[model samples]
Target: MRALAYFKKGDVHFTDSLPEPKLTSPKGLLISPSFTGMCGSDLHEITDGPIFMPKDGETNILSNESLPLAMGHEMSGYVKAVGPEVTKFKVGDRVVVEATISCVDKHRWPNAKNANTPMCDACKDGCENCCDYAGFSGLGVVSGGFSETMETIEHHVVKLPDFVPMDIAALIEPLSVAWHGARVAKFTEGKTALVLGSGPIGLAMTLVLKARGAKKIVVSEPASIRRELADKFHVETFDPSKHGERAIAELRSIPEGGNGFDFAFDCSGVAPTFNTGIAAIHYRGVYCNVAIWGKGINFNPMDMTLQEKNLTGSIGYTVEDFKQVVDAFEKKKIDPKECEHLITGRIKIEDGWEKGFLELINHKDTNIKILLTPNNHNELD
Candidate 1:
């Protein structure tokens, strides 16, 4: 099978001899990927990584899969085959995968080291995203969608509505990340939100806020290109660089009552965004960290203490988030055409390395989501 894979640390490339994936469980489905989005995390695996990816010679603790795996988790595909016991989907169904792998998935790898271990507390409580051994399918747990085909059990697969195009379906994974952040923040309809940084996840947070009926959605980004992208989603855009020390105060004035936002999400994992997010929200408001930080930042507990503001962070998402995002699209809450604005480019898997990965690394501001296809299902011309 041809694939774009992580051959080793700092060595991802396109290859033709990678083995085709197989359905390992009775409820599994074989998927021919239609579109797979390139993510910032994928770029990290090349520059600063093996972070979530297994080291060159080691295997993932959960899946027991080694390196050189196909490298994408944000994917939309068509069902190619199903195991005998798979009942929910059949051949030719359009779908997107939730892709989170955790201790609850021990059944899929009965021979693995921890297969017989007890379920983690998080999984037992139905929070697989927070499982003790949480990892993603493409990140390291299993071969993922940047290939000829990939396989995952029914638990991770979500059926796509006919109205949602495959390209738009690939955005569901990131949207689910934003959805989970909003869920963690306990966001509600008619609440105003302040989303810091209008990068991919930041823009995604904007769309989710709109779909959930936010009274006002303000995206604060320093980059002009990203602010332009956020504006296309029909949200208010702010440039924090212009205000310097007064950024937080200016952000608070945008929402009704001029007090502060009901919720603020820091999609940019920096100290400034972190502090600004907390200060920009009103008393008892929630501030959720949605970005992946590389290092720790100093914090003043008194900030949250005085205002009774809540501080929390969201990581990977559950299958339920994927379902709700798809439902949002089906009900026209997340307009598919609006979602199209996030897809900056599309390329064949053969060009995934130079055109997909490096393009994002070299010119991060110019693109949002760049999708790659194996050319399966005629997704590419």
Candidate 2:
């Protein structure tokens, strides 16, 4: 099987010599990927990595995976084969796999109150996403969605609605990330929000905010194209370069009596955005950090101290998040048709390096998401 993989920290390319994936556990399922998204993290891994992709020699104790790792986590595909133990799904089922690797036994939450089998302490607390050593399936684990075929445990698979297009189903992964962030921050109906950045994650955050009935949504983005894209979602946009510290002033004044946003999500992963996002929240408000930053920023304790604000960070999504996103899509809360704008380009696997990865690296300000058709050549309508 052909796969785009990370050979070293800064080296990643498509290779035809990659072997076809096999199930490591009887609980696993094989998927022939239809559409796999080129995530910003994948670009980070290819450019300045070894961050989450695991270094050449080191193995992730949880996933037990090392390097030359296949890249890609956001995708949707059909179940071509299933292990004998996989009873939840069978062959020919359209599904989106949640990429998180939990420490608990399968069949825990969203069904039974608890697992009859023992689980990790974090998993026991219903925080498998925060388990001590949870690793993402695609990043540091086995072959990921970027390959022609990949295998994942059935516990991570979520069945997609028949009405959802395969290309749109590919977005379920990132949408779940945004959904999880919103869930973490306790975003509720009638609340207001300020999202920092208009990249894919930020845009997805805005859409999720809207779906949850956020009264006012404001996005601060420097890029004109991204700002315009946010505007299409009916949210106000601010150019941080122009507004500077006054960006928060605009966000606060949007709501009556200048109460400020109930939640602020920083998806830009930039030092400056971190300061602005924290300052934009209302007193006692929640600030969710959704970006994967390279280094720590100098955070003023008074920012959260005086205001009594709550600060939190979000990483990968849980199975519950994936289920919520699929439910939203099925209920028309998130329209797949409108999300087509997020796909700036779609390329074949062989062209992934130039069209998928480099296009994002060179023109990230203009592109939102790029889909790579690893196994199929059909153009998304």
Candidate 3:
């Protein structure tokens, strides 16, 4: 089967020599992936990793995988085969793969099935996203969505509606990420929000907020194309570059009364954006960190304390988050027309670097959600 594999930092290659995956567990299913979306984390992995992608000779405690890893986690596929004990899914079931792997008991079955297996206090508390040993399936597990196929535990697959196209279905994973942050911040209808960036995750947050009935959404970004993309969704946009020293003040003015936003999300993961998000929220408002930060930084806790504001961090999504996103689409809260706009373009696995990753990295402002299909290429819609 053809697959995209990592050779070293900044190098991902296409290969047809990798062996086809076989169902190894009674709880596993073989997925013939139709579409996969590249994620920001994937970019980080290819560029500077060995971060999440395991090194040679070192096994991941959860998936037991090492280097030469398969990439691409945001994916949609159809079931080609299933293990003997798998009852919920059968041949030809369309589904999306959730990349998070939990439970990971090293002493027992290190790479054992962890779908419904809660091995941590967080998972035990119904917060699997907070699971201590949570590892991504694509980054370090068996293989990823970049391949022609993936062998995933039944617990990690969610059935997709027939009405949902595979192209759009591939977005479930990333959308679930934003959905989880909204859920964590307890976002309510008619509330206002400030998004720190207009990248894919930030844009997804706007869509989730709008579908959830946010009264006013303000997306702060410097990139004109990104801001324009957010504007197409009717979201009010602010360019921090335009405001300069008064960017926070300008952001505060977007919501009613110039007081502050009801909720703020930092999706850029930069220090300035983090500070801006913290400063832009109303007193007692919730601040959520949606991006994966490059490095930890020092911030004054007094800023959080004086306003009695809530600062929380959200990582991967839970099974429930994916379910809610699917439900959002089904209920028509998220318009398919609008969601489709998020998919800027598509490329073949062979062109993953030039057309997909490099294009995104260099011209990120003009692109979003570029899907990589194993079979063929897809031009911008």
Best by lDDT: 1
Cα deviation of 168, candidate 3, in Å: 0.6
Candidate order by TM-score, highest to lowest?
Answer: 1, 3, 2
Give per-residue CA lDDT, model 3, range 1-381, as digits (tens): 888887667878888887777776788888988889998888888777877777767766665556777788898888889988888999988888888766632222434433344468886787766877766767765578888888888878899877788899888888899999999999999999999898899989999999899999999999888898899889888989998899988787778888999999888999999899989998999999999988988899999899999999888898888889999999989876788889988788888888888898998788889998975422311
True-vs-predicted CA distance for residue 196, candidate 3, Å: 0.9
Model 1 poorest ten-residue lDDT run: 372-381
What is the overall TM-score of model 3 with all chains considered together? 0.93
- What digit string (tens of lDDT, one per residue) describes model 1 on residues 1-381? 999999888899999999888788999899989999989988888899898898878888878889889999999998899999999999988899988998767888888888889999999998999998888877888888899899888998999998888899999999999999999989999999999998999989999999999999999999998899998987789999999988888888889899999999999999999999999999999999999998999998999999899999999799999999999998999999899999999899999988988889889899999999875565331
TM-score of each: 0.98, 0.92, 0.93
Which regions of candidate 2 are displaced past 4 Å? 105-119, 377-381
Q: On a 0 to 100 scale, what is the lDDT of residue 38 in model 1?
A: 89
Winning candidate number (TM-score)? 1
Per-residue lDDT tens digits for candidate 2, residues 1-381, read 898888887677889988787776678799988889989888777777776776778765555456777788888988989988899999989889888766653332223322233567977786778876566656775668888899888878999998889888888888888999999988899988889999999999988998888888889898888899999888888887886667668767776679777889999888888877787787999889998888887888898989999999998788899999999988889988777877888788888888888888888788888888888835532
lDDT-better candidate, 1 vs 2: 1
Query: Per model, how many backbone clashes are there?
Result: 0, 0, 0
| True-vs-predicted CA distance for residue 23, candidate 1, Å | 1.6
